[model samples]
Target: MDAYTQPRGKPHVHLVVGGGGLKVTDQAGAEKFGDLPWKTDLDWIRERSEVTVSRLAELFGVTRKAFYGWVEGANPRKGGSQVRIAALRAVLATLPSDLHRTAFFGLVDVNFTGDASFREVFQGPVDDASYQDRLNAKLAEINPEIESTVKRLHRASPSSRAFESEYPSA
Candidate 1:
């Protein structure tokens, strides 16, 4: 069977040849590629948002196992998936880290952009830059005080925020 088509939980090898016949393999089941950042990004979303792996998979129209691989440091097969993940992270970054999961869902469910929910807008291919700009502008228009307040709270000390922040460099 082709390695990539194997079922979940089964060990599979991926070979990448380049650089004068150089070969890369996933022998021990570790997805060693450009996957470190994927793991980190997924971790960040799980830590700060209501977006569970299942929800993410559904939103991106992929299987839950796919997200598991991504969280385990596996690079997505498509560049579009990577772009969507990055875009979601960027959108979430605008909100306060202390926002509760329920609040996060509620906030994004609002149809601020048009007829579709933010979830729908993010689920498909679109102009990310334009979407972000419109989303931010609409949010600010709805309530500048709330937007500014959330930003301030998101930057506050860990004690005041939902998640801990790293210490500054010495």
Candidate 2:
């Protein structure tokens, strides 16, 4: 979908780079730098996640040149494969803001036995159940009350008809 278009039904991730620096927003226009467990500002993730370009390149599974291009504001959706882009987005979503820079860098760099990289871990077959489970676990850890409230709000959200009637599709 185009930048201005919103996905049908539930909220969708939206990434944009502007004067405010790179910002990730949901369909509700809520600014979500990152999600649970690994929340951090997009600028920090882009500039400080890795000590060097090569390391960042390895994490994203892209060439140093390409990584530089992305750093210079290349759109992953337009310049990279969809699966890779999706994996990158998912990995970024979990970066905790409170995580130590060194620790966060190390976490993404050290490829575990089966996992190749943070991107690789989420690059498997399209299965959101496992992702959701991880998110839920992190949410519980961070703030169970907020998690419960969000669930309640989601459950109480307007139906598709009601939503459509309120905000007609463009």
Candidate 3:
């Protein structure tokens, strides 16, 4: 039988092609790809933001092929660089769950230019300063206090931040 077909009395099998060549694994193993650390985060971001692979690719400045490959168990680092991953995480964190999708679309459409969607707040190819300013502006609309706190933290010295002092050295 072909790799796609299950043999009689056999557990479900799946074929995955990777750097090591073709791999055959049970159904559980196949699904484990979805359980990768970055996959979990990516899934959460996709669900929360109602984003598609195309949109996410644009946001992370990656090609759609790379993005979908990552979703299908390819190395996430191959999909986006470390800096891009960190920026994506930061932008996702700043998004308020309370912000309605319709409202977000309307706001982004009016205030931004060039692919002016909620994705614009997180996606990059632009300078860091411009990206951050856009993100801050979006956050300000959803929750001014959060925006203020973010600015305060950004302006604070590293030594003055709570995380620096919260834990004592062993």
Best by lDDT: 1
Against the reference, the lDDT scores of all candidates come to 0.61, 0.48, 0.58
TM-score of 3: 0.43
Ranking by TM-score: 1, 3, 2
- Per-residue error at 155 for model 1, in Å? 22
Worst 10 residues of 2 by lDDT: 33-42
Can you give the lDDT of residue 69 in candidate 1?
A: 68
RMSD over all Cα atoms, model 2: 18.6
RMSD of 1: 10.9
Candidate 2 yields a Cα-based lDDT of 0.48
Candidate 2: pairs in clash: 38-94, 38-95, 38-96, 39-95, 39-96, 39-97
lDDT of 3 by residue, 1-170 (tens): 78777556746988988633467879888878557666666666666665567766765667887776666566655423444555555666656552433234334434333435545555545445576666656545555444554556556736555765797667
In terms of TM-score, which candidate is stronger, 1 or 2?
Answer: 1
Query: Pairing residues by index, what is the TM-score of model 1?
Result: 0.54
Best by TM-score: 1
Which ranges in model 1 have alpha carbons more than 4 Å from their true place?
1-35, 110-114, 126-131, 134-170
